[model samples]
Target: MDKQIGYGRWKAPADVMARAMARMRERERAGGPRKAVIGSGKEALAEAIRRYPNDPLRQLAMFLDASPLPALIGRAREVSAKTRTNHGDMLRGAIGDLKAINMKVQRLDQLNRRQVMALAAYWTHEKGQTPGTVANKLSALRKFFTQVGRQDVVPKREALYEALAVTGVSQQMVTRQQVALDTKAWTPKGVVPLEVIEEVRETYPHEALLMELMLAWGLRVSEALGLRPHSSDTPNFLLVHRETKGGRWRKVPYMKDAQKAAYQRDVLNRCRQWAEKSRRLEMGYPKLTLQQARSRLYNVMAEIGVTLEQRGVVCHGLRHEFAGDMFFDITRHRPPSENGADSDWYKQNKTLVADAYQQVSEALGHWRREISSAYLGSPTKMSKAQRERMEQSMQLIAGNPDVKQGLVAAGVEQFWITGPAADGVLLRAGEAMQVAGRFQEGWTAENLKQVHEVLRAGVARPIQFVVSLEAQPQGETLEIFLDR
Candidate 1:
């Protein structure tokens, strides 16, 4: 965990890199998840309950605790500490609320449907939790029941929505726009306010380290704590924790420029000091073991009123801050989450936007490039008013040489608007076609089945990008079928 620090730039060591390679060879030989399937997480949960009795965090850390599983559902392993804490809190809160009203729920199976809806009602009415918050709490509780092999105990989301008088969010949460609309709680997708972090640091340094790691590397709470000595062995990139999502180890390179790179190295070096033998995120004496470290990390933050549940300033937002910063660093343009570029910016630079999306996706350790949409919004987040204006702009000057050059450069081309056609207008950017104002309503999905059926026909790849969200391209407002 120790690095030679004297003040100059830190370079990746040769012997350390060799040692890491050796470890990699050993790991590859060992294979992934060679351990037998064994019993379900329920078995581990029982053992946890026995050992920790009163500690709900430790109890869930048994097997249902990796940085994956029920939360992501087959995407990653582990129930995150934040998630574990929420599940515990939600379940206990619900049970206590039930008991207060003469209902009983001592065991997992005893949590009834009515009790679940009642809790939802109380959260919305009495406590005044937003639909998103209530929904997340219910989901966490449902995960507890699901992981225990007793999913039926809790009512479904439909019932919860009906009782709570709200709508269900997507399983794959598109939170970028939602965060923008949020009034009270804020997203750190852009700049993480330093003052808020300093306030946290003034209170708890240990917790600050975890938050700092997430800010620096865009790591999950579990991933941030799983930092190791070998994590920073590479010269260019730092190896993210091995036990990452889906057990896949990601190599996120050090920060791009010199100054930021030095700060990143500093963060990793300090974090590695906390890494211990066979324990994830071991800082000093008491902060040993994943559960202990994780619990302390979150518990302290909650105390400081910086948790997402608390709607505090510096919760899981640091990761989003990293995303926004990394995107700007790579693309030189702020992300939509940062309120940087509207859909038109993306429309003008599809290729550039795609490349930036790919890089940010890799930086965020996502195999699916589009998944970055969760953190960064889709390219076509142009508002109706914005689209109307762009549509009018395009209509006013469809054959302008400048627009033609810009659109063609991105492979999302707009044809000459000054052409006449039997149908609507004769167009020939990549392929010859007639686009009239009549069927523009057909451009629904991304021209990816969301748009006109005619344009989608006979083309494996979308030839045109739809710039307007409303597909109001009378002349040529499209040239953005996001192909990242």
Candidate 2:
């Protein structure tokens, strides 16, 4: 049968309001997030917005208070702490967007094709909302309509994307391999220089500190805001206090470089002073709730032009730059961008590569090293530098008479070099060192005595080795020999 309000399938707005109030009463027996339920819901809802017929935001708040879709939608009818994070705020944002274009939509049911298109443009151009954010906002719109018995008002996804494209937010055309591999690199998205932080510090000192922490430790915004000033700092490391995504706890170290370390100390000291003066060390966000704190910081960021829409960079990009900078600091190599070394480097220096990824992942508070690939890049192809190094070494070694003879005989040989400056030559020939085997003549008593010396420790480490052979084999032609 067709739906009927307060009968079957559909509950009147007042009926939902009463049910939610009753739930709150039972839960005081558990708490409340939503607007307070007043005497006879619909009447109170109407009165709150009767004066603001032009303000859609006020009207939506009234609608949410009276209807509260969760009361009808969820099996639990519970208002979670994450309600704002997931859906509530997103819905509000969509309605408020109408105000930007001066549409004056008093009722959400009045949300028309013109308003939806305008919102898409606002989010895309004015707000610079990411594609993921845009999708979530659209979802919130659908949910609002679905519960309010106005699903037909929601625009098709294709139409929404088309509207977004008008504002230059085109649909992402990703290939199957790209989707499966997930190798989008965000390195050096743009450097957040010290001057930007200082400029923000002049107005919003605390928000600037959060940005500083983000750049210094690769902290997510929530993690930075949720720090315990006293306990977070060990002598060398900063423990993520709380509010981690997925509750991940990580310890980021004060940098090894002297200047970086000093800067870290300075930041910590300032944070400590601020916490002591304004809030207890334990009260990371102080009197402000999570929503209030986020709104305040984001407003400040926008004012200071910290957004991608404003400064051509967003706060999250700090984490990307940090990942890139951290990888370089640890491995002395650039993090993968559009052009970076592929698995060939990892193939040979597996341990080295693993260690670098491990340290960076830990510092960034990500459990898996693979997740870092989104911020740092994963190169699908060989880099020019790596390819050049390998080809140059291969050409040089392959051209040699001894190397060619060894290759012809057994495909591999015990290769070594004894030259005037053998150390420098070996250092320069890093890629060649993999094939450069240790020279040991047959197991004669004299050759056996050479055992304990253990020339280049772990030569199967297929790397560099430095040693002196007993009897000088004349010239540098002593490149390839048998493994005997």
Candidate 3:
């Protein structure tokens, strides 16, 4: 039996040492049992168990017992040297040019623990060694021991060389509200008033008109920059087809007087100048790089004493303004209702209003109603007076007998108007003549047939019609025929 103390200064009895040696020998013969080593520290244990499973105590005792200390020391020295070559080489090379300045591993071993710590401190503080560098060096040292054939001395671990990261104190995240256009976020504040538009027009006469267009239309800087003279020739409509931020192509329309004028003159001139000066391309082909135009616009605004913190308006703001104004107008002019139903023109002409929204969506290149509604904000309730007016309009359109006769004269095959007619009757029209084009045109046989189909379909808003002498010259009443 061998008498030896374990690594942690624990002494093993002679009998225990004998048993451990036997187990170590068994491990060597059969190889390490799967359970002997597991988890992170298992690898080194596995190797040791595999090498001397049956004689583990004898092997372990060699390190602990002074009688066998000389032999164990020699073995350790050999293993350490081998490890130094492989792991140490890799780590030394990783330091790159710094290797020349550092002591070799052999020298490192001669230094005391305090000396080693001081050296590490110097590398970090003086040389600015990054965490990654420390991690790499640690990995190399661990690898060296395992590779040097002294695997028994090394601990088995998966994350043995991983750096312990220092975490900073964290606080709760608080969201900040967005600042306005004229806020410090933007360079030029108050750049979008009418006066600024006038200044741009006067200063850059060639591009003056186009600046006005941008002020009126909520176009992107790039779209405005790309304006050409030919754009003015295409009626009052502006065709916008371009690739935006997410690399998606969109086609929308710009329909405003200011937009039309700006594109014709000022915008065209600048585009022409860019073509001639920068790209040396044909002046007839108008296009601007996305960055340059935005920069130019900001510079102009700055020169005009626009502050970044207030009133900075971008081309996109124009769209918001337009949508906001339109939404207000529609709500303001809405007629009233007679029934208890709170009168809202949108509610009254739900389908037609929906159609109008759809048209706007198409114009804005939006695929959803909710997205379009951003400009409308939340709907407001109407007053009783407004409701009464809506009811009157509904009744007038509902009870017009002239409409029914007209539908008949126009040869309407079949038509229907849901709910009660002007006289509080349901299914007002049996068959009516079609009304072609605008309601202003006189009804024809074709017109009467179309009107019949329209009524049958059940429109959102009631159609308006005036009584004709040929049909019936009397008090207005909605005339509708329901066929059994």
Candidate 4:
């Protein structure tokens, strides 16, 4: 039988209109029409009915099965590849968390703000996750939703903020408290003791040289493995030419002091012996990948009765120990005494301590002194006057035309004069802010001497300066322009 539909047009009698109205009413009752499901319902129904003209139930089922999470998760994997760390693991964990909450959500648009908060609470209490971890997971989910153009699914920051403020709620809901925990207890713990090193040496004799490099020079496992000796005029010093994690080709000197030079020479000799031994045994050079090296080191450490996990330490602890030792050696200040009188030296030589940290940071292939704090504990705070003096010195050197001309002649386009030292000036250069050559800050005769020395040292680029005002008169005689 044919029925008269819109404008007296004859159409087959079917319950399509009734089914669509029922679906819309069900959605409206559930909460409200999902933005994706609103206009999509009619289109889906029409497409299904057109494809399966003889089946009415198939049309209804097809309209109800639409989901967006699976596609969004696929897109998330693509995004994770661009990150330095593995974000896929985090996403997988987030998915597991969603499943635990029994939201059974197929589409991102299905979950409301309240449901999201419930998941947060579940992670905080049932899963016993830290505030930072919870925040990070939520942030990852938020980023995913935003990328997939379903940002409305992400709970509002205000809602999360209010949830955190409520008392007697789940631990995860206390976001402010968790944030405080992150700030106060975010310090890295990596300081391997000497006894543990000895035990490791005994367990893995072949890796002794590598361990020594990490302890003495603070070399990462990769850096130590990639090292090859280079010929230099300074026989005592080992010329290490390697690409650091920061993507800079650095020429770091391994033997900077008499003690370090002696230790490094011994280690080099020992390495040669090990290579010769391996060749004799026909066991190829003891070359290892970074993971292999870390595994071997960890295995040896575990056998030595050292609980690295309990101590909150890792293979990098040797590097931390080196940084701490170097800081103390350079500053000649021990850890603060109970009465705090032992730190008086730090107050007296705040600039020197800062400079030492800067040097240590560079030695570790890092650009920032603040990072050194993780290894060598936090440095003593500097006074306003001390900071001003350092700034003044840098300005004095930068204001000198001769100094600027010297750098420009060396082909350096732009540079930052960090601070002044007794022997030279500390500076960072280029758009990357790499540590450039240290230029001497002194009297006219001394300054000219340093310029020649710097040029001889192959610093063909412009070098930043940090001179003192006391040397200004002598600097003026060098026909230098002193602007501003």
Top of the candidates by lDDT? 2
Residue pairs with backbone atoms closer than 3 Å in model 4 (clashes): 407-462, 410-460, 410-461, 412-462
lDDT of each: 0.54, 0.56, 0.38, 0.47
- Tens digits of lDDT, candidate 1, 1-484: 6554122233445666567667644543543222322223566666666777655445545534432344342222455667667666775676667766666543443456667666766666667667677667777666666655666665564544454443333332211233221111134322245555677778676667777777777877777666554434466776664446655555677766677788788877776665533343343334367667667777777787775444444556677677767777777776764446656667888888777777777676665567666666654542443345345434433434443333333334233221122112212224333332222333333433333343354233223333433334553323322212
- Could you give candidate 2's per-residue lDDT for residues 251-365 as a string of tens digits? 6887766777788788877776666655445334678887787787787778888766656667777776666677777766766552334466756776776777778877886
Error of 2 at 104 (Å): 45
Better of 1 and 2 by lDDT: 2
Residue 302's lDDT within candidate 2 is 84
Stronger candidate by TM-score (1 vs 4): 1
Instruction: Please give the ranking of all candidate structures by TM-score, highest first, separated by commas.
Output: 1, 2, 4, 3
Q: Give lDDT: candidate 4, residue 41.
A: 35
Q: How many backbone clashes can be found in candidate 1?
A: 16
Model 4 segments more than 4 A misplaced: 1-86, 92-128, 135-205, 230-257, 269-290, 301-316, 335-355, 365-368, 379-484
TM-score of each: 0.45, 0.43, 0.31, 0.40
RMSD of each: 16.4, 18.5, 31.7, 25.1
